[model samples]
Structure formats: C-alpha cells, structure tokens
Target: MATFVIVGAGLAGAKAAQTLREEGFDGEVVLIGAEEERPYERPPLSKGYLQGRSEREKIFVHPPYWYADQEIDLRLGVTVTGIALDAHEVALDDGSRMSYDKLLITTGASPRTLPGQAYTLRTVADSEALKAGFAAGGRVVIIGAGWIGLESAAAAREAGCEVTVVEPAPTPLHRVLGPELGEVFAHVHRRHGVDLRLGVSAEEVEADGVRLGTGERLPADLVVAGVGAAPNVNLAREAGLEVGDGILTDAALRTSHPDVYAAGDVAESYHPLYGRRLRVEHWANALNGGPAAARSMLGQEVVYDRVPYFYTDQFDLGMEFSGDTRGYDQVVIRGEELEFIAYWLREGRVIAGMNVNVWDVVDDIQRLIRSGGPLPPQD
Candidate 1:
C-alpha cells in the first residue's frame, strides 16, 4: 500500500486524511502537526469558543477516537522542519524522516504580531488565555478593528471589560467592507459602548497599554492584537515549490510538483470563476478544500471553485458575507440598517453580497454572483 502523508494536521489536513479513506483508498495515512492538540478549527478561537459560549471539545474537528478508529497515524507535537522534494521525504523535528508516495501541505497560517506585548488569537491556547483575560473584566485595548479585533472587543465587552479599539483606517474593516458598510460596523460598536478610536495608529504597545500616533496613551489591563495572518509557506518555498502569496497551485490543487498538492489557506489556487489566483483564509475554504484536494489526489477530475464565505458574531449582531468583493464599483443596499442585504457590483454585475442580521439569502447571493447578472430592478 502506498503511504500518503499530510503535514500541519489542521482542519484541512485532517479532512484530507478522512477523505482519502472515504474515497476507498486503502493506503497508509499519516497526519502530522506541530501542535500537540488534535485537528481543530480556528474560527471558534476568536468567536464562540473565545466568548466562553462553546465547550473546548466543540472546537475539535474530530474526537480523539476517530483517528484511532480510522487507523490513521496521527502524530501531534511533531514539526515538519523540512521537505526534501527530490527524496519524497519530510524531516521531522524529532530527527525522524518519513517517506511518502504522495504529499499534501496544509500548513495553514499564523497570526501577525505587533512590535510589543499583546495577545493574538490563532490557537486554542491563545483563545483560552484571552478568555481568561476577558473574564478578569478589566480594561482592554485592541490594536486593530478588523474582524478578529472587533470580535475580541465584543467578547471583552461581554465579559464586562472596558473596551477600546484603535485602527488606522477611517472606519472598521475599511479595506474589506469599504467605507459605506464599514461605517455601519462602526456605529454598532460605538452603540455598544466601545471606544472606537478610528484613523489612528498604535505607535507602541507596552504591557500596560498602547500609545497612539496622535501621541495619546491608552492605558489597558490587557492588549489584544488582530492585525492579520501570513501563510506558513517556508516549507514549500524551501522545497522549491512555486510560491507567490502562498503555495501556487492550479484549479486542481496540484502544486509545482505532480506528486505534491496543497489546500486551504496555504494554497493560492487558481479560481476559474474570478479568473485569478486566490488564497482564502476562511473556515469554509478549509472545510471544502481538503476533500476537493483528496479527490484530486485520487486522480479524479476537480476544479475547486467554491465561493468565498465567512460569518461573524459580535454583540447582538450576526453577519454572513459571500463571493468576492474586489474591484466592485457600486454597493447596493436592499434593506435598512442592521437587517439589510448589501450587494457589491462591478458595472452592472453582482460580485458579492452580505446579509447583516438578515436571514437565509446566502444561496441567492452566491447564485447572483455566479450568474454575474445585472440587478433586476423593482424587487
């Protein structure tokens, strides 16, 4: 039996191993991760799980028993230090080497760090520590107003902590939802008693507080940083794979080497629909990309063209966004305030849609984007 090895045992890697078995591949499967914990999803690390609304076990992709039952060699707390593409082997930190007939890299990404002392949420431990800080219910100074920062602010506020968010942008999520919708988010946070200091940079982060570019110092009991994340592409780059913003792959998820494949946030795969390569670092991407790559690895025809999707919950607001919003010229609002659907259009074609406090229209939104149709007025 051929041995299939998966590196970085995240949600994508675990799902890939499961897919290999489900597709009737009677091969030796190995899942290796640098984290001692089993495969788990990351969303909860900043959402429900961080808010103390979700149990620890719920964050796991699979129970511990599942791996044993599936006869997979799940190696945790082990790092793949190097990948020797020519030899078809990976060098582990423990001084062990493993050979593979086929290899999949799902190494994922790491949270970007700030210049000084601050916490970031990327793993379970990170969440737990943040959760404890929130539970302490003191003052919190968040260094970004992006998704993670805003969500952490909400959690901190819920825990009765005095919260303040500092962002260099004119409004929260300015680059993402743009100015119009970004203002809406700003309104919500401000309404919920958050001190949102917009258009100012966090010049310095100390253990006690944050200093702004405006020369104002905001004291804090705890600091949380949510700048963004960068894909873990060192292994692929060192192995001589074609890497750009991430490991470059085709629509089939095949990397520069035929015997090696990539998926999830680490893989910048060609998107047939958008006519460009995209690296979507969202739960939906990993949830679906893994299985797609597995099928492709089994010599099945595959085109990974799923629409980008993500959801967020903060305070009493819940929102879902779908499709690509890049290069949109217009944003159309269908409803009013919090319970509305917003559409991003290029010329006359719908490119993306977001429903805030609205219900059950993601399918319609995605269909409209895929159709690239002109908005039919009067509905």
Candidate 2:
C-alpha cells in the first residue's frame, strides 16, 4: 500500500485524509499536527466560540474516533523538523523518521505578533486565554481594523466588555472594502457602543492601557493585536521548494516537486478565475481546497477552479461575497447602503459581488460574475 504522509492536521489536512479514503485510495494515511487538540475549524474561534455561545465539540472538523474508524494514523502534538525529498522521508522532533510515497503540506499560517502586552488568537489555547479576560467584563483595546480585530471587538462587546478598536486606516476594512463601504462597518460598531478610533495606533501597549501615536492613552484591561497572519512557508522554503508569499503551487495544487502537494492557507495556488496566483486564508478555501488537492494527488486530471467565497457576521450584519476584487473599474451599489449588494465591475462585466443583510442571492451573484456580462442597472 502507498503510504501518504500529511503534515499539519488542520481542517485542510483532515479533509484531505477523508477524501483519500472516500476516493478508495486504500493507502496508508498518516496525519500529523503540532497542536495537541483534534483538527478544528477556526471561523468560530473568533466568533461563536469566543463569544461563549459555542462549545468546543462544535469546532472540530471530525470527532476524535473518526480517524481510528477510518483506519488512518493520526499523530497529534508532533512537529516535523525536516523534509528529505531525496530519501522520501520526514524527520520528526521525536527523533523518528516517516517515509511516504506522497506528501501533503497543510501547515497553515501563524498570527503576527506585536511587541507589547497584547494577545493574538490562533489556536484554541489562545481563545481560552482571551475568554478568561472576557469573563470579567474587561476593557478591550484592539489594534487593527481587519476582520479579526473587528470580529474580536464585536465578540468582546457581546461579552459585556467595553470595546475600543484602534486602526491606522481611516475606516475599518478600508484596505479590502475601500473607504466608502468601510465606513458602513465603522458606523455599525460606533452605534453599538464601541469606541471605533480611526487613523491611530497604539504607540505602546502599557500595563493598564494603550498609548496612542497622538499621545492619547485608552484604558484597557485586555489588549488584542489582530494585525494579520503570515503563511507558514518555512518548511517548503527549507526543502528548496519554490515559495513566494506562500508555497507556490499550480492550479491543480501540485508543488515544485511532483510527489509534494500543498493546500489551505499556506498554499499559493493559481486561480484560473483570476488568471493569477493567490493564497486565500479563509474557511471556504480550506474546506474546498483539501479535496481538490487530494484529487490531483490521485493523478486525476483536474483544475482547481472555484469562485472565492467568504462571509462575516458582526452585530446585526451578515454578509457573503464571491469573486475577486482585482482590476475592478467600478462598484455598483443596489438598495440602501446598510442593506445592499455591491457589485465590482470591470469593463461592464461583474468581477465580484458582496451582499450585506441580504439573503438568497449569492447563487445568482456568482452566476452573474462567472457569466462576465453586463448586469442590470441599479434601480
């Protein structure tokens, strides 16, 4: 039997193992993880789970016994020290070696750290630590207006804590959503008793609060820095694999080495839809990319093409989006700003669409984007 070794047992790695079994590979599968816990989905880590509205069991991608039942060797709390392609083996931290006919890397990404009294959320342990701070209704001063920061702000407020979000940008999500739509989020957070401070950053994270760049100090019992994440590409880079921003892979998810494959947040896969390469770090990408990488590993002719999809829920807003926002010439807004759909158009063709507080339109929006034709003018 062909032995397949999978590094990093996140959602992508777990799903890939499941796919291998379902596809009747009948191979000896090994799943390894640095984290001691079972593979779990991360979206809830910053949302439901952190908000005390979700249980730990609900976060797991698969129950504990599922791996044993599937006849897969699941190794938890282990680290891969080195990958030896010439020998078709991996050196482990435990001084053991694992050989594989095929190897998959789903190492994922790590949260960017700040040099201060600040916390970042990445693993369940991180969430648990933050949850303890929220239990006391502590004052939270979050640095960064990105998705993680905004979501953490909303969750902290939900926990009866005083929340203040400080961003260097003019508005929340300004870089991704642009200033106009970013203001919408700014208004929502401010309306919900959140002190949304724009165009400022913490000069230093003090013991009791944050000192702003403009010489203002905000009291904070808990400090969170959700600046961003960096792809865990050191392993691939060390192995002499092509890496740029992330581990470089083709549309089918194959890496520079034929026997080596990558998926999820760490894999910079070529997107046929955009005719370029992008490394997407979202729940949808991990959930879908896992199986795609598996199919390609099985020597099946495949092109991993799927419309990028992501959603977020904060306060009373629930939004979903499809397509890429690159090279868009115009943004068309339909309905009111708060409860509306925004379409990014390039040369009269829809390139991306986002809906906020709107339901049952993602399918149609995706169709229009894929159609790459003119959309009806907003009434």
Candidate 3:
C-alpha cells in the first residue's frame, strides 16, 4: 500500500485524511499533530464555547474512536520538527522518521501574541484560559478591533466585565469592512457599553493593563490579544517548497514540490474568480478546500472557485458575509423588519454580500453570485 503523511491534525488535515479514505486510496495514512487533543471545531471557541453554551465534547469534529474506525494512525502530541523532501520523510520531535509517497501540509496558523499578560484564542486551551479569566474579570482590555477582538469584547461584556478595545486603525475592521461598515460596528459596540478606542496604538501591556501611545493607560483585570495570525509555513519552506504569505500552491492545491499539497489557512492557492492567490481562514474554506485538495491529489483536475464565506455572532446579531469585498464599486442595502442584507456590486456583478440578522437571504445571495446577474440597487 502507498503511504501518505499529513502534518497537523486541525480541520484541514482531518478532512484531507477522511477524503483520501472516501476516495478509496487505501493508503497508509499517518497524521501528526502537535496538540494532544483530537481535531475539534474552532469557530465555537470564541462564541458558543466561550459563552458556556456548548460542551467540550460537542466541539470536536469527530469522536475519539472515529480515527481508529477509519484506520488512520493519528499521532497526537507528536510535532514534525523537520521535513526531508528529497528523502520523502518527515522528522518527528521524538527522533523518528515517517516516509511517504505523498505529503499534505496543513499546519494552519498560530495567533500573533502581544506583550504582557494577554492571551490569544487559537486553540482549545486558549479558550479555556480566556474563559477562566473572564469569569474573574473586573476590566478587560482587548488589543485589536478585528472580528476576533470584537467578538471577544462582546463576550467579555456579556460576562459583566468592562471591556475596552484598542486599535491602531482609524476604525474597527477598516481594512476589511472599510470605514463605512466599521463605523457601524463601532456604534454597535459602543451601544453595548464597550469602550471602542480607534486610531490608537497600544504602546505597552503591563501587569495592570494596556497603555496607549497617547499616554492613556487602560486598567484591566485581564487582557485579550486578537491581533492576527501568522501562517505556519516553516516546515514547507524548509522542505524546499515555495512559500509566500503561506505555502504557495497552484489552483489544484499542489505545492511546487512533487506529490505534495497544502490547504486551509496555511495554503495560498490560486483563486479562479479573483484571478489571484488567497489564503482564507474561514470555516467554509477549511471544509471545502480540504475536499478540493484531496480530489486534485487523486488526479482529478478541479479548480476551487467557491466564494469565501464566514459568519460572526455578536450578541443578538448574526452577521454573515460571502465573497471578497476588495474591489466592490457600490453597496446595495435591502432592509426589512429586523432583517437587513447588503450586496457589494463590482462592475454590475455581485462580488460580496453581508447580512445582519438576516439568515434567509444568505443562501440566495450566494447563489446570485454563483449564477451571475445584474446586482440590485441599494435602498
């Protein structure tokens, strides 16, 4: 039987393994992960799990016995220290080597840490620590105004902590949502009693809290860092594979190296729609990209052209967005009773859509993007 080696046991690695089996590869599949725990869903870590609405067991992507039943050799807590591309083997931290005919690098990303006693939410342990800190919080300082930072702030506020968000940008999500929608987010957060500080950089983080560059010190019992994430591309780079913002891959998700592939947050693959390279970190990308990469590895010529989609649940609001908003010419808003959807049009085509408290229109908007049509006007 052929041997396949997969590094990382996150969503991408797990899904790729399952896909290989489903495709009847019948190969010696070995999955190595640095984390001791089994693969679990991460989206809930910031929302449901943080709020105590979901149990630990419920967050798992698969049951413990599922790997054994699938005949997968899951080596948890085993980190791949090095890769020998010429030898087609991976060096483990335990001084063991695993050989493979094909390799999949799905190491994913690590949270960017800030100075001082602050925590970044990327793993189950991170969430656990944050939850414990939140339970005993007086004032919480969040360093960033991105999606994760905002979500953490909302959760902290709901836990009865005085939350303060500090961002160097002019407004929250200014780079992603632009200044317009970012203002709406700032308003929402402020309305919920959050101290939304924009255009201010955190000069330093101390035992007491965060100090702004403007000589303002925000007191805090706990500090949460949601700055950003850096892709884990060290292994791929060491293996002589091309690495840019992430592991550079073709449209088929194949790396520059032969018979090696990458996917999920770690892979920067060519996007058919945008005609450029993109590294997406959303749940939809992880779930869909895995199968697409697997099929490509199995010699099926396929291009992953799905619209990037993600949803954020902030308090009572359900915010869903699809497609890229990079070059949109205009935004069209459709407002109803308690439901609103915004469509981003670029050159008469719907490039992206954002829905706030409107769940029903999300699918239709995505379909409209897939089908291609003249976008509706903004009210």
Candidate 3 positional error at 105, Å? 0.7
* Residue range 1-379, candidate 3, lDDT tens digits: 7898889888888998899899998879898889999988789899999988889999887899999999999999999989888898999998988888988888999999986888899999999988888888799999999989998988899888899999999899887877767777888889899998899999999999899999989988899899999999999898789999999998899999878999999999999777899999888888888878877878888788888999998876779989888888877777853368878788888888889896777778888777666755642
Instruction: Output the lDDT of residue 200, model 2.
Output: 90
Q: Poorest 10 consecutive residues of model 1 by lDDT?
A: 370-379
Question: For candidate 2, what's the RMSD?
Answer: 1.3
Q: Across residues 1-379, which tens digit of lDDT does each residue of candidate 2 receive?
A: 8999999999999999999999999989999999999899999999899888899899999988999999999999999999998899999999999999999999999999888789999999998888888888978999999999999999999889999999999999887777767888999999999998899977999898999999999999999999999999998899989999999999999999999999999999998877889989889989999988988889998798788899989999899988887777788888895799998888888988899999999999998888866766562
How does each model score on TM-score? 0.98, 0.97, 0.96
- Residue pairs with colliding backbones in model 2 are none
Q: Which candidate has the highest lDDT of all?
A: 1
Question: Measured by TM-score, how close is model 1 to the native structure?
Answer: 0.98
Best by TM-score: 1
How many clashing residue pairs are found in candidate 3? Answer: 0
**Which digits, one per residue and each the tens of the lDDT, describe model 1 over residues 1-379?**
8999999899999999999999999889999999999999999988999888899999999998999999999999999999999999999998989999999999999999998889988999999999999999889999899999999999999899999999999999998889999999899999999999999999999779999999999999999999999999999999999999999999999999999999999999999989999999999999999999999999999999999999999887899999888898988898887899999988788888999999888998899989966875334
TM-score of 3: 0.96
* Model 2 weakest 10-residue run by lDDT: 370-379
lDDT for model 3: 0.87
Off by over 4 Å in 2: 376-379
**After aligning candidate 1 to the native by TM-score, how far in Å is the CA of 325 from where it should be?**
1.0
Better of 1 and 2 by lDDT: 1
